[model samples]
Target: MAFFPSLNLVARRLGMYRSGGKGAWLFLPTSSLARSRPGRLRPFHAAFSTSAGAQHSEEENIDHESSLGRAGISAFKRAVLARHSTKAFDAKREIADETLAAILALTLRCPTSFNVQPYTVTIVQSEDMKQKLAACMLGPNSARVLQAPVTAVFAADLDPVQLVPRVQSLERRKRGLPEAYLATLPFSVAFLAGKGHLAHAFKDLFTTAMSPLQPMPSVSTLEAWSYKNTAIAASWYMLSCSVHGLDTCPMEGFDGRRIMHELHIPASRYAIPLVVSTGFAMPLPSSSPERNEEAKKSPRFPPEAVVFKDQYGHAYKGISQL
Candidate 1:
């Protein structure tokens, strides 16, 4: 019997028992895939069929090895980080759907303030939608977004922290996290998430469906809040992709109002945060030795220079100096 690397990866790496904790199958490593170029292999799954009589510890041993082989447990992450965005993508070939989905899944898992993940993402696949987004692409990015196989928009809800009380209301119930955890933090989360919603939806939700007597924050505050929060989420998405191996172009040069009008997204309900162009890079002049020699060899601060001891001015005189 033949097995695909993806399936083999899952089969061998997973616990035979379906509910065996981490043994459970989770498809699409979004962060990893987002970092991947279009043609690059997105090994989302690995197959490992367990021995019917194998001991549990042996299974653990296998998992340990699997971790080590994750992208070869590579030491080249820094090199990947130094890579710049490509202005061109080979759009003739399409990025696999699963791969794209995986990329998005990472956004879902991305850290949010108090874990209040409040971002709306739209994937532009149709030619017309891509056309609509073209103006959103900046200078060199404009050409790339038009030619790329897929363009994704990352939009966030502001004041997402407003949703914290509700989140705590729900989260505290699960695993019994005390409702007090919310207060211990410097800021309120439910307030943020709720604020995000208000920024994005309150005006419309009130005008179209409210009691007609409800008070609300001014339109400008809500708008500003939504734009601010969504941009943060979008930035996180970009950095996460950057560390993994994907190239992302964060575009702000387009007409947000036109995008809202064309996409049918109510201006009151959502604001366009960023149009991210994803795929393999088309090799930059910067990648060449002549262009990058200086940047690549740029000096890095000594560990001691940055790592300050307990006090701000306390210099580390020696080891255990931490």
Candidate 2:
């Protein structure tokens, strides 16, 4: 797949080019970075308040935990830089159950819209499901999905809906924000209810239930939330994979409607927004380049373009009076 280089991102990360609307990258001498101790330069966003988080696209709070230990940083840097999406997987390669578990465990810790925790992880490693998934995604993707060692499909249950009111009431109390107001938060955090509400509540009332309707509606919204929530989780998992010399590909171009049906999930109970295909890479052809030149230049926008002062449109890089 052609990596659509977002000019804005390129300009910000690399500081070399600023075509389109991208910000300019300045030459920060190696001396300057060396003089500045690591971890001391607070990520600009980290220092900004919600007053700022609200204005700019609120990037996630990356509370990094060094699971890699003393040399973990170097290893992590290696993993991230090397990691890339692979639509094609070698059929001979098998994804160990333990490795898959390790990856999913990382995702399970993914932050939810609320503490309500509304997503489910479905690892479709079954040959049956893989075939069905492949069929669903259509020709090439199906072949890839079937050949791939593991396909992790993310779903959302209506379980969070039940707690919405309660969560909302608490949000209002805790932060003086309205109940269910988190929907306005910068990311895809969501809440939904379980199916038990109407069934169980009617019996308790001891009245012949007049309504036989399902309690929840709008499966798309649920799936969308799960996609965002799990995408973040999957991002961390991919990073973990990179460090361990494993490979991962986050793919959504597949046919999700077919996957939901093939997986035997009810229309109401489950919603799959995205599928992440992960496995080992194929052997490089003898003609393959010694260096992945395009990959090497994972261009980014200049620091000035992304970082700003106290307000929007003001570029602030910690001014110091000499």
Candidate 3:
């Protein structure tokens, strides 16, 4: 079976478990999928499975290579510091096809709960589609949507339970997990799904109604989990774009229902978290005082204010302490 190198690394890093000389599975509750292009949904199960039974120790593993090099890390930090919710873009500039591919590949490497990978990116590349998306966004954001070379709608799958079983099994087998370990997954999933009424209903229908013998997994707050996981992927996408000399603006001020309709996403199956506009950035105005202020860097809280050590209230000290 052909596995994505990133997926393999993620599977390893995220606790790929094995027992009884079986398969190795990356244990995550969420199922993430990759879409090479718009309107195409491919199952990641095959791509995530492997025939090799070789077990890897966390320290000695060579498959776990960093996608971001020293230069990439520097670029990432600069991007994080420099990135803004850009409202203006160089509409004349277009992202190269290879660059976009590289960005998506990196984006899929983001971790998810249970390794379920439960989201899809709908790429809007054409001007007509961008205009349609703009109609659903706020007046101010509409221009940015249209001006960017691409607008990616990050949507979460409401019914990812359907895809979990195959992925779980394949990933587990690849990791050489035993049947005893695999048996516990059903109950774990059911317990998670049980947390939320909507999630419980959707997941229970499959685990119980479809197969009364199995345990169900539902989340207490399904939408929250979905949004959070998808956002991680979105962040990765934006940073990856930054590393490729591109820009992005993550927008939430849009009509979700209208976006669903425009994008042909069925309301029953998917939920839109936000739309991200991607392209080259236009230079901030230098002469205008108001525009200059807009160009000023935003302040951030110090590390001591946000970083905790052992306990919640304990502030983390400098690296010298380590």
Task: Point to the candidate with the largest lDDT.
Answer: 3
lDDT of 1 by residue, 1-322 (tens): 0223344343333211222333323222233333534333212121111121124545565755345354633534454444455557766657677767666666666544445555687887787878777865557767878777777776656445445566556655653543223332223222222444543354344223312222222233444545665676676566555555566666767777787777776666566767888766555565477355354344556657766799776666664311
Candidate 3 worst ten-residue window by lDDT: 35-44
Off by over 4 Å in 1: 1-83, 159-176, 179-187, 190-236, 239-245, 283-322
TM-score of 1: 0.52
Alpha-carbon RMSD, each predicted model: 19.7, 19.6, 12.7
Model 3 residue 199 CA deviation in Å: 7.2
lDDT (CA) per prediction? 0.52, 0.54, 0.67
Better of 2 and 3 by TM-score: 3
Task: Count backbone overlaps in model 3.
Answer: 35
Q: Which residue ranges in model 3 land beyond 4 Å of their true spot?
A: 1-72, 172-176, 194-219, 288-296, 319-322
lDDT of 2: 0.54
lDDT of 3: 0.67
Give the per-residue lDDT of model 2 (tens digit) for 1-322. Answer: 0123453353234222222433322222122334544333323212112232232322344435636575867766667678877747788988777777776676666666554455666788878778777787754666678777887777665545655566556656765652112332222122122245453343223112211321221223344545566567667767766665666666667766677788876667666666777788776666766246364334666666777888887887854321
TM-score for all predictions? 0.52, 0.56, 0.69
| lDDT measured at residue 62 in model 1 versus the true structure, 0 to 100 | 72
Top TM-score prediction, candidate number = 3
